[model samples]
Target: MNHQEVGKYWNENAQTWTTLARAGYDVYRDHLNTPAFFEILPDIQGLKGLDIGCGEGHNTRLLAQKGAFITAIDISEVFIQQAKETETQHPLHIHYQITSAAELPFAENTFDFATAFMSLMDIPETGKVLSEACRVLKKSGFLQFSIAHPCFDTPHRKNLRNAQGKTYAIEVGDYFTNQNGDISEWGFSNLPESMHNLPKFRIPRFTRTLSEWLNIIIQAGFVIEQLHEPRPSNEVVKQYPSLQDSQVIAYFLHIRCRKS
Candidate 1:
């Protein structure tokens, strides 16, 4: 799908995304991706930052609370509204806008750093978005992002098990092929009753191979700084039992890059 179609898909699913965010990014992000990301993040005290694809501004608010003057943007109007409402509830120095990542609306070299947390895979034009990120950052500025591991989270994924039915390995297909559309169910069984009753949810996503992701950032004038493949901790598994197998299978990849 094209950028416009991708935006429309997100707009249609914004309410569900908002509900998921409100339910907390704790299980998915906090327990899984955040630790690896923060390890490479420099102190943001007294810095200007941009949060591309900042869903409901949860992570953007964290940036503000950490002392970064944040400018957060999302393509979905409903998501932007929800973010603004969050800002009103608890005042912060955050400027929120409804804008696409492919075309950022900011002066060149305006931000010290930028971030896209688990958002790149959802965007159709990854190269364009990365270029826009580079255009907005000062020389030597950094961008930290996390996404579902393209290799493991392929268009077709399956678990390989033995006679005992214990997952030994994961099987993936179409690893090198770029693919998009509503490939997976978005709604979870454990969601709140109000959320469960909502219509069937299937969000659009675009997938690129690992090399494609790296090449895009390099072409956008970035040098790779750090790469992390995070697995849920044993403690986390105790709290969220379903994530036990995640400890063995890589679920997410985090990258830190600096503008050259």
Candidate 2:
């Protein structure tokens, strides 16, 4: 979608932005649910941090509370407004900005850590964003981010079935764009032929394979420090029978790559 349309969508939903952030999305939490906030934050204590695509700044505030100086950023002015507004009495310092993920506005080696949560796939020019993240971090800084799994969460996902009926979702579409990863529409969970009538608002995602993603970090002079597949809590498992081990099936992929 065009930036205007994207801005309109967030503006329309701005009122509920914080509420949703705290409501605990199954998919997002599955990849990120943690014992302590600081655990996911790693060792960024006393270091500058950036939260890219920081809608409503939940994580930004969380990081601030944990004592990391933060710069929270978003592309949508509406979202940035909501984030700043939600932080009415926030004692800690948090700089908020309206900016694109692909083209971050920061000097080289400026941050000690950065994060993008469940927003990478939605971003166009993700490679550029990753490169920018690499550019802005201090030596040995951490760049953590998340996205939906392409194999399991893409529009063309694999389906599971049984004698009774279909048990899981099915998807079928091209993984990579014919062009330079500049997609215009992207949606999921429909019959294969539905692309004609229901062309999703294609959002360009550089179709990086698992190996390719790892290589991006290595090539950008970072090292993979951790890989986590955060499962749901026992409570969520009991509350939602569909979620085995609190795993929100099609939610996100959490990665932590450290600058060398």
Best by lDDT: 1
- Candidate 2 achieves a global lDDT of 0.64
Query: How high is the lDDT of residue 190 in model 2?
Result: 25
lDDT by residue (141-231, candidate 1, tens digit) is: 9999999987788888887777875567888898887776655565643466755577766678688899988998899899999988888
Per-residue lDDT over 1-260 for candidate 2, one digit per residue giving the tens place of the 0 to 100 score: 44434545555554444444355532334333433223565766688999988877766777787788999888877778877776666656898999887778899999989988766655545566788898999998898877655545443555455566434544535655222344444333222463346433434443455665677667777788876655556676566444542243534457888988
- Model 2, stretches more than 4 Å misplaced? 1-38, 158-207, 245-250
**Each model's TM-score, in the order given?**
0.92, 0.73
**How high is the lDDT of residue 92 in model 1?**
99
Candidate 1 clashing pairs, residues 3+ apart or interchain: none
| Model number with the top TM-score | 1
Q: How close is candidate 2 to the true structure, as a TM-score?
A: 0.73
lDDT on C-alpha atoms for all candidate structures? 0.83, 0.64
